[model samples]
Target: MADLFVSETQLPVEVRTHEALSTEELMVFGQSGVKEFEIARRFEAGRAGFPQSDECALAFFEISGRTRTVIREDRLAGGAGQPITYLGFPPARAAARRLTGQGVVSANSETTCLSRVDRAA
Candidate 1:
């Protein structure tokens, strides 16, 4: 399975290429060795009315024959969106993550935003 490793600080994307392991495997060398910490930080920030920056640095790694290679690196900018007015239900977060992942995978040119609005029943 493909895994994504994210860090607030820069990751050594170049040097890591020589290691014969997937990004998930490399996690064992880190302090936490778990990716959930970053996910939690994002959720916590959202809960506290702080939205994450729209920009992200992404590096795609893939296996070519017997070696893993960094195929592409790019910045994902979601652009500015309206301020978060109301927090949606728990499922909203999952939906947001799914949509964002799709954007990253497709390298979409357009930005998408999610907002919650209550309508009369």
Candidate 2:
């Protein structure tokens, strides 16, 4: 079971190889730990408001592996919808201790639910 993790794209592309942006390139985004080889847009062009530039973060998840089912459905710091793509494959799920090296000095209860690795092990 692959998990996914995402955070604000405040670093260089080298930092977040998963980052994808809309045609305008202002509304930047990235994803981590996905199983689906590809995901089609659920909505059409102009179907939803275009994604924004200043909003903070985006998250993606794999709904199932049965049919390459990865859902780009997201939780944003503020807004939604832009260009999209299936970012190849992540080496592992959200099991990583850190997302782009922000900080891991502390771990919360919610963090356990997100990590695939058993830290206690």
Model 2 segments more than 4 A misplaced: 1-20, 24-60, 63-92, 95-121
The per-model lDDT (C-alpha) reads: 0.27, 0.25
lDDT of 2 by residue, 19-93 (tens): 243322311232322311111111111112322111111121122112232333333753453223434333222
- Model 1 — TM-score against the truth? 0.17
- For model 1, the superposed segments whose C-alpha errors exceed 4 Å read 1-30, 43-51, 54-100, 104-121
Clash list (residue pairs), candidate 2? none
The candidate that achieves the highest TM-score relative to the unseen native structure: 1
Residue by residue across 8-116, what tens digits does model 1's lDDT show?
A: 3333333234233333343354222112222223222342222332221111111011122222233346334322221221222342354357663322221221121
Task: Looking at model 2, report the run of 10 residues with the lowest lDDT sum.
Answer: 36-45
Candidate 1 local lDDT, residue 1: 12
